[model samples]
Target: MNAALKQIDAWQTSLAPTLPTLPGNDIDWLAQRRSEALTQFSDIGFPTRKTEAWKYVATHAIAKTTPALSQSTIVDSTQIAQWRLDDCDEIVFVDGLYHEGLSHFTANANIDIKSLAESFEHSPDKIKALLSQDISDANDAFDALNQALLRDGAIVTIADGAVVERPLHLLFVSTNTDNSVTPINNWIFAGKNSQCNIVETYIGADTTNNLTLSRTTINVADNAELTHYRSQRESKQAFHLAELTVKQNRDSRYNAYPIALGSAIARVNVEIILAGKNANCTVNGLYLTKDKQVSDHHIKMYHAVPHCTSDQLFKGVMDDSSRAVFNGLILVDKDAQKTQADLSNRNLLVSKFADINTKPELEIYADDVKCSHGATIGQLNEQSIFYLQSRGVARDQAEHLLTYAFINDVINRIQLDALRKQIAALIIGRLPDSEFIRELV
Candidate 1:
């Protein structure tokens, strides 16, 4: 068989059954999407140095070879104890398979939170209505592949008039057994007048050539509000690719905060589609890297209707020989009049060899819309640093404090106080233990 056909065979063979919990959809549906997805995957399989989108941070290091798909394993209690949270209902997934014992879902009238596999069998109609309805994969191969081979993940659907008082935490840990591979496609939907918060985190207790490509789509109905917090702190040697696409209805609002601090090669692609009039959306991200790691974040907001608004701000701090990439694009369709969008990207490089690539683009077709974008890449303000040093602050301490303050601006915008403080400490602690800071302290 040809290489492509061989790949198809490998993927099809990976869908073998064990306990038959996944009452999967027809192969015809899967095959139809898979065929379309394969065409996209073939068009852009593991972007190379030649691809403009990946021109700066190449994936050749992680893509030199392909590893076999790993088998899903059970998460023993000893390992489950290690996963901790505060005042939150936790849903744990071990290697893309939901763990019932480790999960606690309050089946209240407020919301419907269940495993995708379970929903496939129980709520097939709802599943058929919303699955892959908001996420786009025609331009992305990893997303396309995820749609083609999705097996396990969670689906959070918030019903009207229900406000989840407590935050929903979705935790996925990679129990990479035997060095095989796996990825999960997920979705979350919030209904009209509903309010909820989501904290999705990815951490690896065990790492191999583990590569996770995940796609999450969220829909905010009329007059609804959702605050999403995502944190990535996986093993430094792993490869991670994540995409979040949000769709907003009239008078609906969506806010997203993504924090990246791990992986050898990581990419985050987020897009917000304003399909309804007078919708609003905000996108924010903070990435801290050191030790020659590479992190990339790409954001796109499309104003498909009139009287919508979008705001985006992304900040980064890179040290050692590590690199960061930020690309923010705002697109306003021709008919989308009176739209307002603002975007900005800023990066702080702390080392001589650190690299950062920032691009802010705006494509405006509506003449009356208000839109602007700006980007800046610079170091610590010398005057501020000198003043702090003059005030008895040690040189290293001054720089650390200044750097912390620079990043705190973005951190404080997170509306959830507990999660904001938690992520802030994570960002501050990311400052490497340099010889200079050590000696000064």
Candidate 2:
């Protein structure tokens, strides 16, 4: 057999012993879903270069390594203290399994939170309907694999007309360096007229070379509002792939901010559907890559009904030999009149060898709609650096300031004060002369 086939065979053989141990296996419907997902994964394996959505990314390395699923590890509280945010209700997952000891959050009457395993036991029918929904028409191997090896994750539900005062934080940490994979799946439901904020953070041990496959599904009911912040700062030796799927009802609103920094290879896919009239969405993202790391973002915004609106802005700063990709599309259906959509992707290549591939598309079948999409890829402006130098700033420090400003444009849009400050510090720490930059800021 060829190398790809061999890798696929290896994964199938390795996962056989653990299939029965998966959570929710005792439920007939859940077990059948898992079996179907596993069958799909076994048949198709991972995506290749021919896959349009993943054309810019190469998966050969991941296939060759074929990391095994990670086991729960004993993590110290001190190791994760730095990643925690203040005044937020936190849920912790270590090495893909829910870690109750490291997680603590105050309960609110309007909010209901439970682990996936707990949800299966208490609300099997609801979990079944959510998990059974299709993510996409085309077969996605990663999605299949995530469901097939399903473990523990978070399930959050907000009551109608409720307003949450504190943000909800879901933290996932990886401490294993034995070339393992961690799969996580989460669900969030916001009832009518509710408002809340959620933050999802992923971190790994610095020296570990693990893999993480994560998926989060969200539903916003009529007149509800949700702000979602996703921060990915894994180990530089690790691989991270994540997906965010959202459905918005009439008059619902969703705001998203995604920041990517640490990982050898990281990819995030976002899909949003405006299912009812007057739904709105805003997605702003930033990705900073250094060394030989690769970062990618794919977004799909669908306007299914009339009077819906969406706006997308994504920026990337590539240093050293790092690479990045941005693929965004806005689709307006035929009957979706009065739709307003816009998408823009801007990239900065700080190194001569650093590169970016960006594609922004607009497909509007409604002639009365207003939609636009565009992309820009360029380097730091020399004149701007010279202008800063003329003001008594050193050339290197001036460049650093400009780079920080480029990324901060999106970071500043975050409404949560504590989370914004934490994200800024993390971004500043990744720059050259971080301490000096921090002092200047």
**Candidate with best lDDT:** 2
- Model 2 error, position 302 (Å): 0.5
Clashes of each: 3, 0
lDDT per residue, candidate 2, 1-441, as tens digits?
877778877887776567778877899878887778777887877788898888989887777776777898888899899988899989999988888899998787889888997778888998878766856542678777787888778889999999998899999998989888788988899999999999999998799788898989999999999999999999999989888899999999999998898889899988899998999999988999999999999898999999999988999999999999888989889999999999989999999999899989888898899888889998899999999899998999999988888877798898888889998988888888777677766
Pairs of residues at least 3 apart in sequence or in different chains that clash in candidate 1: 69-181, 70-180, 70-181
- Model 2 TM-score on a 0 to 1 scale: 0.97
Alpha-carbon lDDT, every model: 0.77, 0.88
Best by TM-score: 2
Model 2 score (lDDT): 0.88
Pairs that collide, model 2: none
Q: How do the residues 72-122 of candidate 1 rate in per-residue lDDT, one tens digit apiece?
A: 676776775644456777788777778888887678888877787677667
